[model samples]
Structure formats: structure tokens, C-alpha cells
Target: MILKDALPQGRITGTGSLRTVVQTVFDVLARFRQYMTHPGNSRFEPLFEIAMQKQLYNLLLEWLSGETTNSPDKVETTAVVASWGIFGAAVQWSRDPLHSTSEMMVHRVSEVAAAALAPVLGE
Candidate 1:
């Protein structure tokens, strides 16, 4: 459901599709946070994290590829960078001392991601 509904096909730029993708990634992470709150308890944490990030990357890739104008190579690269950026910020949000809300995190990540992917997701 996450990837399938990530973005509308074609004309995604400047139409809030990017925000949808970012929100989906955060929503998935928020669900995972329930099970992964304590990373220190597991020995396979590093492997688990890599797998999770890969899933997020694919989610963004699905959205990027929805637009026919994006080249295959560029879609993969942008997805990789944006996924990492989103996941990295999510990790920080989890570790924050003030414990900001997920809504705030989603909004902040959306802004940063839109800027980061402007070349491909924007005009």
C-alpha cells in the first residue's frame, strides 16, 4: 500500500506528491519504532537498519519512477540519497532529548527532502 499509493503517475512535481512519499516513509518508521526502540538489545541491529533503509529507498524510488520524465539512473540515485536523508533524520528524531512529535519530524523532513530532490522532483 505504501509504494502503490506513494504518488500520482506523472505531473508529480510541485503537486505535493513528494510530501506524500515523505509522510509514508515516516509513517512506516513510526511503526517500526515500536519494535526497535531499544537498538542496544539486539546484536543484528546494524543489519536490520540497513534492510529497513533499503525498504525506504525503494519506497522513494517507486514514487520517483512514477513520473515518466525521470531517467532510470537518476531515479535510483535520488531515491538513495533522499531515503538516507529521511532515515537519518528519523534516527535523530528518535534520539532527540526534547522528544519532538512525529508531525514536526514529518514536516521538517518533507521540506528538506523537497529541496534536496528539486532537480528531479521540481521544475
Candidate 2:
């Protein structure tokens, strides 16, 4: 679905902040793509493992088949697959007792996203 159509339609009339939200989501997706595609980046292996454990890989197949129930159709199945890898990585790391895996993973994703978007943001 287009970003405008991704917004809540009942209580929300206009697109409001959803446009920005979708833009940010797309920017993050780009950064994630770069990270996953790079050969030197060691993050993908662990993330892929997590995705397997979480069954996100299978969900992605279903998503591609247009058999999902809740996700937005316009987001694209490949996008969901990539995002699931990132999210699964976060969950896997968060299981560590010594670190706040969730916070660290979020920080990592945000850092990559900000750097990737820096030129686009003109800073």
C-alpha cells in the first residue's frame, strides 16, 4: 500500500505523520539492505539465523504469496523479509544477560539509518 493508505483511516482523516513515518521506514530499509548485502559485514549470519528460528523466512514466503492477514500489502514482501531479519537479530541479541540487546540493536539500526540518510538529509 502507498504510504498514505498505510495510515489509520477511521479516527485519522489526513495522512498526518504517517507520510514521515513511511519515509523513515523506507530509509531504514535502504540502510538495512546495504548492511545485509555487504560481504564484509558479519551481522547478516546471526541475523539470518535468528530469522530462521523465528520462522520469518517462512512468513516471507507467505507474504510473497499474498496470504498474510495483518501486514500492509504495499510494503512489499522483500521489505518484510529484510525487516524481519533486522528484528530477529534484535531479539536474538537481547537474550544476552549482560547487555540490553534490544536497545543496542535499535541503536545500531538507527546509526546505520542516520548515516545512510545523512546525505539525503543534507547533513
Candidate 3:
């Protein structure tokens, strides 16, 4: 429910860059990082993490598939890999003490994600 709301309006129909998808996801999880890391939620953290990753994967699969891309046939693999990268990074970022590297991390991940979806509309 919260995740759905974090997503951009009309993005469920996909039709956008991988960079945007990844950045949007990062923003959402970063906003809710406290919930996942709180002491009271420690017992359910492991299961929550797994479920979150799976949900993101499936959502990204559908979103990527709907995207109009140069490499239409590779969307499945791209989505799988990109989703993992995005989720993993967010988890690590959430645990870190310093946020000094946040923008750098996002840029780096966004670049890799953009590559997978390249010949992507803007570049």
C-alpha cells in the first residue's frame, strides 16, 4: 500500500526509464527505512526483507515489460538483475550511519540500471 503510493502516477503502466524506476524505489524505501530497522520489528525483519525483495522483483518485471525499449526481448533478465541491485543497495544504505555517499550510490546504481535499458529514449 505504501509502496504503491510511492510509485509515480501512471508508472504502473511502465513506459519510462530504468533510472527513474530505480530512483523512485530508492526514495520510497529510504523514506521508510526506520520501520524496517526499528528494534521492535527485529524479529520480522528477515522475512520482511525477503518479501520486499520478491515484491519489488515482480513489480519491476511487469513495469519493465511494459516499457518500450530497444531491447524488448531482454526486459525479463534486466528487470531481475536491476531489481536485485536496487533492493540490495537500498538495504545497505538504510543501515549505514553516514548518508554522505547516498547521492553517489544512487548515481552509480542509476548508471548501471540505465545501461541495461539503453538505447533508452533520452540516452
Q: Which candidate leads in lDDT?
A: 1
Compared to the true structure, candidate 3 yields what TM-score?
Answer: 0.66
lDDT of each: 0.71, 0.41, 0.64
The lDDT ranking, best first, is 1, 3, 2
Candidate 2: stretches off by over 4 Å: 1-75, 112-123
TM-scores of the candidates are 0.68, 0.28, 0.66
Best by TM-score: 1
TM-score of 2: 0.28
Q: What is candidate 1's lDDT per residue for 5-121, written digit by digit as tens? A: 666763235427667766666666566566666766456557756877887787667767865477899889998998899888876675562588878888888888888777876
Residue-level error in angstroms, candidate 1, position 29: 4.1
lDDT of 3 at 63: 69
Per-structure clash totals for the candidates: 0, 1, 0
Minimum summed lDDT over a 10-residue window in model 3 is located at 10-19
Q: Residue by residue across 13-104, what tens digits does model 2's lDDT show?
A: 22233223223334343445556667877566566445443443333233333433434443344435444544454444544414553344
| Candidate 1 pairs with clashing backbones | none
